[model samples]
Target chain A: MESEKAKILPFYVLIDVSASMSGDKLDQANRIMPQVVDALAEAPILADKVRFCVIDFGSDAQVRLPLCDVLDQHSSLPSLTIRGATSYAAAFRLLRSEIEVNVKQLKADGYLVHRPAVFFISDGEPTDPEHEWRTAFQDLTAGFPTYPNFVPCGVDSANPRTLATLIHPASGPKQMQMYLMEKGQNPADAIAAIAEILISSMLASGQSMAQGSSGMILPAKQDLPAGISAHSSDDFV
Target chain B: MAAPEEGPVRPVPEGKWQGYVEPFVVGDPGRAAAGVVPLPDESAWDRKDTVLDAFALREGRARIVEVRAASVRGLAHRAYGKVRQDEYGFRRTANGRYLVVCVADGVSSGELSHKAAMIAAKGGARWLAGLLDRTEPADLPWGQFIRGVAVMIERNGRKLLRGRDDLDAEKCDVREVAQRLATTVLYAVIDLHAVDGTHAVHVVTVGDTSAWVLREGGRWEPQEAVKNDGAEVFSPTVHALPLPPATEPVPVRTTVRAGEALVLMTDGIGDPLGQGTGPVGRFLADVWERPPASGLEFAGQIGFARKSFDDDRTVVAVWPVNGR
Candidate 1:
């Protein structure tokens, strides 16, 4: 028991930086990212086990920060700017490849990696054909070793039903969540809320993982700020 | 009837358990000057077995009960994760008129949160106990009270890290180094002798860990409810020691006569209880209503089929034996 050290709980934030998320949405993402990172950094036990990754998806994908342990992360997360089109396939595919490499790396480093959580934030539907993005989702979420707990957060003009499919979790430790950003609120505040929820959700899940429970146990949808919350999932308890 | 209590029992602690332990923040002499002592040994942390130690204090009416155990998940994961980041302490004033109960939850992300929790709980209990023994301030001085504790922890934390230079409070580098050992605190100062015969319980909270009182008629009132996220407690604006510019503590006052119980707990149990619906809800209700007979019995129920959540759960409870 004295020898048992808590495993690392990795979190990935995937942003869709298509043209639609250009103005306030993208700006808000840049402004609020440091707060999110700071919140995670402020936690004692969580900072120790939780590693963070920020990935951007548009016409192509960008690995802003490869998997870096929050404990060792001294700087803020890389901010995302506007890009071509919302290419879900490019993001998921890149994530799939990254997971294989990163998970292995963390394990090689002697830290038991708990199932990771991927927060997929997007606005509009995929610019790519549905068939391609859907196929990418399958490959990224279903595999031999495992898939991450995917939480798809759809903001302004994004289709909730389609986003639901992206939230399929590969393991019990993973939980399914879909947040719909509400309209009418200040866009900046809304974007900040999104970052807050993601950080909060990740911290909660990471804590559950550290304690040795199956995986992340997120807050109920009702717990979220109004206008954004967990869309009903068969996985919801 | 509950299953017969079974476990290899450790001896009940005598005198100050904290005095024997060194603060993990042993690196800086200044931080060491502040009193952030670490545990004496690893065995002090509960492993597979439940730790239910009731030490009859010489100073006050409330019998101090410490309830801790390896979370079910902690036990299942080959004991990989250290037990939850919950820590509690009790100290009776030298005047023997007050018993201070303190619980601190280490910020999960903070690498040394467990140490923070330990320091907050013990440091607070001892500080308040000393305060009560000397003078009782008219106003609780919530901010100043916690500042003293954090000052000690940071002073000690810096020492533990072996600071290369003399400390500069205004410097971000020094603050960040000390802030590494962050934690949230919820505490209470219970008057051994009541105000005109009504027991007064003063509760204060910084982060999520909470305090509640249970009445004879099965009345349950919480001093603090679970926040939606860390915003209320975790924000830079809010008060947490080791971190600079600590926020004012949330304060609550309630009276408890005989035949009543007071409970202090961290979020591991609060999340389920705050939701208050399913099996976990029922279990919480039962605990308050029937009150398990022993620490092991109480601990068994805490770890019982909590379903999905696995964060450490700690509950420190006190039931007055007789009317003052």
Candidate 2:
């Protein structure tokens, strides 16, 4: 029998907009928005193959862009407006719904899909309520045979333990990276880097999908940025 | 399965379609993956048949998993008659999942270079899929799979050359035929079985297309040695080479763990950014360090680099999260 031919990858960018990200954090993401869109346009593969979405969470979670291709509607990407507490649980629940709808749509259209990716960017702990974030995360992952790729990026202000839990079960040696965005550093530069990494990861995921491959591996600690540091899961809470 | 057909697999258009013309701007601000070109409905080209329509249909799934893909006649002008080739697919198997992603730049030098690229893409996808299905995930004979894929391509090329009636000596020569269809294939297979709790990543690759991983602390590092930055000699672009003889095979593998992200991409990422580990590496590092932005934001960054760097780029990321 002819094996399946297409793989669908859904990328959700979940940004934290708590009060802590008020200044440079928010500004950097805004400045680098156009550049990120431009990168996808130039790459025909990403331009053609990937569907993208954005969700911003602070007091609550909001969908910036539902599953859409950046190559087609670059200008439509939602603008970021920061204000409120970090409700990570609400954000995860929202992401779960978005992923389900998009995955179904993709399958109905005859595309083979891999698991969706949730890129969680945060600068603080969950101030909304305890265990809510954990419960939502668990419920979302419960249905899948393998866990979806949920990546957590921690800004300097973020609580390491909270970030550790975001990357859960895989904590300790497998904890997420802590991005040390020093004071005065251009937020644009960080945004640009984030964009590049997302695009690169999306592209890489597409490449791996085509090859019938599973998850790609992470780089060694030495290979990453100098300021970024990895702490054991115990270091968090 | 059915026997090989004697005629052309699919019909080629007799003449160019009169599609709306848009400037092939490398770094234009408003370009998106698959949006309407904001014109009067009547003025717009048949939206259904356009490349953007196909993209819209598949974008969601394409973003999440490994899947076969193709893009043609959009970015460049028709005068050059360029047809972009892209194929991506992923399958989770018994031993592991196989991922294949590649962009074939048909030798612009040949009469039917574009055709060759399309064929390579279709044939390659079919061949890889078949091989993955046949091989149990537990017995992922990497070398054997690579050889089988190459053989399938050669075999398909011969069939196409023999069947095409429009081609004469210049285009029909088998050796020249394969040469004209030159493409760079970058494939990676991840063995989840190899994931023994600790971080272990196995990646196999050929040509300049790259494989990388992002660890804790948001550090982006290369998984393969496509270039030697140690000597300060950076050859960032993936080097596409002639496919080795059917008897020989090339494949590399690595193992990865939890809390890590894996990435793979085509060489179209371009120079300066593509040349060394620094630009792409740093770019990814920053992305990992920061919070997750929207896909539009991600595309904006990639589009900026493409315009500034001037190359067709593609990147993919895979991160393993804790189940509970």
Best by lDDT: 1
Model 1, B213-287: lDDT tens digits are: 766665556777645432211111224556644456656888775556777777666655553433444445556
Worst 10 residues of 2 chain B by lDDT: B49-58
Question: What DockQ class does candidate 2 belong to?
Answer: incorrect
What's the number of clashes in each of the models?
Answer: 33, 108
lDDT of 2 at A150: 71
Share of reference contacts found in each model: 0.01, 0.01
Worst 10 residues of 1 chain A by lDDT: A1-10
Tens digits of per-residue lDDT for model 1, A55-167: 99889999997887544537446868888888989999999888888877665543346677888888889888989999999998766354777888888878877887777
Give lDDT tens digits, candidate 2, residues A120-185. 777777886677778888877666443456767766566656676666336443233333334444
